[model samples]
Target: MSSPPEIGTAAAVQVQEVEHVYGTGADAVTALGPISLDVPRGSFLVIVGASGCGKSTLLRLIAGFEQPTSGAVRTAGERPLPGAGAGVVFQQPRLLPWKSVGGNVELALRYAGVPREERARRVPELLERVGLHNVAHRRIWQLSGGQQQRVAIARALAGDDPLLLLDEPFAALDALTRERLQEDLRLVSERTGRTSVFVTHSVEEAVFLGSRVVVLTKRPGRIALDLDIPLPRTGLEPDELRALPEYGALRAVLSHAVRDAAG
Candidate 1:
């Protein structure tokens, strides 16, 4: 088991007065932020909004892929650095086609600086954690889309990075597969106690996955609504939690917020 993060410690991610613009002058387009947020350790934070609301752009800034036009974003009290601060999962699995399932995760472990012997030992364990057990030898093309995504998730966890950043990771899957993966991811996050930031347009997903959900306004995204979900994260099935009245209420509010923000 992984060690739990200390309670009341500094936030895992902090964004301050952040804004992002594209191009410049006549063609300049303001894409995101002038927003601020603090994500506590071990929290599952979901940012939801309409298409083009800059949800993904905000995520990129947090991941250190892009810098904000104004303001600052810090992870672990320093400016976030690409390939250093967090493990990221994108909408597509993007696994290497030539590598076997285990090879993909092994590569991540190697990049994380795990020794060769340790990487071999850790690969299977990571696959199992993402529920891809016994398929470590399968080629990427042989697996279903959902299964490939599981490998992507396993690879993300290979380093045991303290922060997990996902950008619509389940958006391309069928509804049933998406729901299943959501449940699996929630369990994984609870077990590992990693700080997570998820970006999606689905209000239901935001409420279901987040310990806290923030809705962003339309382009030049800003916080439209910020809510805390107090639903039990353990000892409850996914369907049962989704059926809760509080869950519905939160989803409804987020849905409305997203729609209004888009207009």
Candidate 2:
């Protein structure tokens, strides 16, 4: 297999004092930011906080769905644009119900400008990358919730977008499935060396998935804590890694930060 790309040269995403507001004047409410963060290349960075902390708002800003009310956001040193810079996975699968599994991924590849012949070859590869074997022909409704989310992930990975932005992608799944997908995503990130930003409200999840974790305060959402996780990224199984003392320590710290910040 080929080596993973050299992804540590510079920041993959930069948020420079960004702030987002929902409305203007009396109706205006600052939803997020006036905070800055730099996500390094090939890193899995998780942003964790309370529900109203603007985690999703920050994510939208990075994806270029919404511009910041003030400050700036960049991906690969350029202003982020829709359908450029990042591949996004939301809490919902958001797949087209009419499309087959492979069809969904093919559409993403098509939008990504992949040739028709190349898309056929690439669809299965993307599905396999997310641990989906040969469910290509199945309808979206036929798949389980977990399976649907896996398709969403495969679709996101179909493109060569440098950054992967996940907004609580596993939040709706049951515990077992969520844990399994978490492990799969971790392996995928290690293999592909893509810079990823995951947003979640779970401290344990944050520590498990992030090379670095940032905890945000409530409301306008400032950074309360920024931590580097020194745990091994590969080799050990998820359970084994989670049982380590170091993992427990980081979780405890994050748990405390979340509680305090949410108040």
The local distance difference test score of model 2 is: 0.91
- TM-score for all predictions? 0.95, 0.95
Off by over 4 Å in 2: 1-9
> What's the alpha carbon RMSD for model 2?
5.8
Model 1: ten consecutive residues of lowest lDDT: 1-10
Error of 2 at 131 (Å): 0.5
Tens-place lDDT per residue, model 1, 1-263, is 12222223289998877788999889999998678889999999999988899999988988999887878788887778888869999999999999999999999999999999999889999989988779989999999999999999999999889999999999999999999999999999999999999999888889889999999988888998998989875788888898888888888888888888888
> Candidate 2's error at 228, in angstroms?
0.5
Q: Candidate 2, after superposition: displacement of residue 63 in Å? A: 0.1
| C-alpha positional error of residue 185 in candidate 1 after TM-score superposition, expressed in Å | 0.3
lDDT of 1 at 240: 89
